[model samples]
Target: MLKWQWRQGIVTLFFVAVGLLLAILVGYSQPAFRSADSGSLSARSGVKIEYPVAEIKTGLPLPSDRTEVQMAAACLPPQRTPTALSFQAKLVTPEPSRAVPKYKPQQRQEKVHPTNYGNRMQRDVHHRRVNNELLVVLHETVGDAHGAISTFQTPHYDDDNQVSYHAVISRNGTVIYLVPANKRAYGAGNSEFIGINGVEAVQTNPSLASSVNNFAYHISLETPVDGLLDDHPEHSGYTQKQYQSLAWLIARTGVATSRITTHAAIDREGARQDPRSFSFPKLLSYLNQYPRPTEIPPCPLPPQG
Candidate 1:
C-alpha cells in the first residue's frame, strides 16, 4: 500500500510539471501573436506603420516628431501655383467716366493730309526688317489741338518740314484720328527705341537719321495753354478726362506697358521733350481696367488714292 501511494504522488508531480511547461511555451509565443495582430489591425485601418515590430525589438531609434509631420504632409494633395490670369483677375477696375465718347476719325481734307505720312516700312535703310512689335509713343502737342491739326493739314513738300501724328487727344478727351494706323506718321525725328532686342529704329529717308516712327503709333495730348512754352518743365497736369481717354486708347492697342514710351525718351536729337506734367501711374490705373486683348488687330490698309 505504501508503494502504490508513492507511485500516485510521482504521477501527480509529473502532470504538474507538464502543465507548467505548456504555460511557459504559451507565454513565450503570446507577444509574437499580439505583434502580428497589431500590424494586421493597423494595415486594415489604413495606418502607416513607420517602424516594423522587428525593428522596434532590435532597439532601433524611432523617427522624430518632425519626420512624422513631414510624412503626413507628403500624403496630402499638392497645392496649385498662382497663374498670371488669376493674378490679373485681382487687379482693380477703374471707375467709368461720365462722358466716354466713341473714337471719331476726322475725314475733313484739311485735317487729314495725304503726304504727311507714309507706309510702315518693312525694312530700314540697312535692309533689316524692322521688328513687328509696335511701340506706343506718347507726345504732348506743344500747342492747342486745333493748331497741331492745322500744322498737320498744311502741305509740306520738303522732307524736313514733314510732321504728323496718328491721333490727337484734346483736353476735353476728344480723340481725333488723323493718320491711318498702317501709315507711319512723321512723329519722332532722329529717335531710337533701346529695347530688349537692342536699338530699334528705321531710316526711311537717308537724308534724315533713324527714327521710331516706322514701328510707332503716335498719340499726342494737347498741351495746356500754360504748358505751351517749350522751356517749361511742367504745367497744370493733363485733365482726368484726357488721362482716361489716353488709357482707353492704348489698352485697345494690345501694346505692353514696357513698350509704351514717351517721345522724350526716344528722341536722340535732345531737342524734343513735349509730354510735360504727365502722370504714368494715373494712366496705368485706368489701363488696368481693360484686359489685354488676346490678339492685336491687323493694321488696316491705307486709303487708296
Candidate 2:
C-alpha cells in the first residue's frame, strides 16, 4: 500500500512538470504585447490594426511636421487635375483656334488709261509666258496716281524706256486703273519667280533674268506724300485706306492669298523697293472675309488702230 501511494505521488509530480514546460513554450511562441494607454487595455489587447491600401497611398492623418510631410509628398506622384483625370476632358475643352478679323472694302474711282498707255501682249511676250494670271505683285508708285496715269498714257517716244502697272492705289485709297487687268504691265522688271507649282526653270534661273510680269498682276500703291518728297525716303507706312483698297484689289485678282507677294520679295535687281510698310497680316485677315472672282478677266482686245 505504501509503494502504491508513493507511485501516485511521483506520477502527479511528473504531470505538473510537463504542464509547466508546455506553458513556457506557449508564452515564448506568442508575440509580446503592450498597451499605449493602460486605461484602454481592452481596446489594444488581442486586436490587430491594419492600414488600407488607399490610406497607405494617400498617407491619411498626415504628419504634423510640415517638413516631414513635404518630404513624404515629394516621393508621391502629383495629384491629377480635372483635365488630367481623363484625356477626353482635355479634348472636350480644347484651346481656341486663331481667328481672322473682319473688314469693309473701300470703293474708288477708275481713271482708265488709253490702250497705248500699256504695252500690248500676253505674259510670254519676252519669253514672258506668265500664264494663269496667278501672281499679285505689290508695288509702291514713286509718284502720285495722276503722274502715273500720264506716264502710262503717253506713248513713250522711246517705247523701250516705258514702264507700266495694272492698278494704282492713291494715298487716299482711290484705285486708279492704269493697264488692263490681264495685260502685261512691266510692273516688276528684272524680277524672278518660283511659284508653288514647281520651279519655272526657264523663268527663274539665275543665268536667265526672271520677270514675273508675264504671270503677275501688279498693284501699285501711291507713295505717301513724304515718301516721294524725301530724297532719301524711308518706308513711310501706308494709310488704312490704302490697305483696304489694296485688299479689295487683291480679291479682284481672282488669286489665292499665297499668290500675293512683294516686289522686294521677288526682285532680282534688289534696287526695287516699292510698296513700303505693307500690312500683310491685316490684308490677309481681311482677305478671309472678302469675296473674289473665280478667274482674272481676260485682257480687253487692243483698241482697233
Candidate 3:
C-alpha cells in the first residue's frame, strides 16, 4: 500500500512538470504584446494591422526635398472653424474675374485617349473602402511644356509609358488642361499618401504598383529651359506668374492648403524630386486671397451591384 501511494505521487509530479513545459513552449511561440505607438503589427493570420498616430500638419514651407518624410506624414483633417465674417468683410466682395487667374482651355491630341488614364477609385488596392479625399500633387516637367504635351499626346499602349496630368502650367503662367479632373491621371507611380486617415493609395492594375493617383489631382509645371538637363539640381525657379496661377487653380478646387503636396512627398521609389526650388510661402500668399468654399462636392458613389 505504501509503494502504490508513492508511485501515484511520482506520476502526478511528472504530469505537472510536463504541463508546465508545454505552457512555456506555447508562450514562447506567441508574439509579445507591444505598444500601439510602435510601427505596424500583424495578426496571427499574417494580416497587417496599423495603429493611428498623431496627425501631421501640412503647408509649412521646407527648404529641400530631404524633409519629404515630414511632408508625407499626414494631410490636414477637415476644418470646422468658422470664417470670421465682419460687416466690412462681407461688403467688400471681389469680382470672380479678379479672383481667378486666366487659363487656356486646350485638349490633348486625339491619340491621348482614356487608355492613358483611369477613373478615380473609391477603394484601395485591397478593395478596402477609403475616403476619396482629393490631394494636389505638384510636379515639374523635365523639359518644355510642349515637349511634355507631345509625350502625353502620343499613344502609349504600354503600361510603363502611359503618363498624364490633369493640368500643366507653362513658364508664362499658361494653364493647359490635359486630362479631366474627374479622371485619374498617371502622375506618380508607386506612390502613397500618409494622412490623418492613414495610408492612402490604390492599385488599379495588378501589373502596376500602388499609387495615390486615384484620389490625386496632378498638376505639372513646365521646367525652365536651363533646368531641362536631368543632372541639374536647381534652376532659376518658377516665374511669379506660375506661382500665382498655381495658387489660383488650387484655390478654385476647394482643397485645403494642407492637402497640397509635392511629388517628392508621395513617391515611394525615391526617384522623384520635382517641383524643385518651389516657394510654398509665395503660393500660400496668393492662395490666401481666395475664400475657402463652405463645402466641396463629394466623389460620386460606386455603382451598386
Candidate 1 lDDT by residue in tens digits, 14-103: 999999999999988743311222544422344444322211221222223213322332232221111111222112323344443354
Query: lDDT scores for all predictions?
Result: 0.67, 0.55, 0.68
Candidates ranked, most accurate by lDDT first:
3, 1, 2
Q: For residues 10-98, write the lDDT of model 2, one tens digit per residue.
A: 99999999999999999998643322223243322454322111112232333232233232322333221111111110112112234
Q: Candidate 3's residue-wise lDDT over 127-232, tens digit each? A: 8654446788999998898888888888789999889988898888877888877777899999998764468677877888988887788999988877895756
Q: Rank by TM-score, highest first.
A: 3, 1, 2
Each candidate: RMSD: 22.7, 28.2, 14.8
Identify the candidate with maximal TM-score: 3
How far in Å is the alpha carbon of 79 misplaced in model 2?
53
TM-score of each: 0.60, 0.53, 0.63
lDDT of 2 at 295: 23
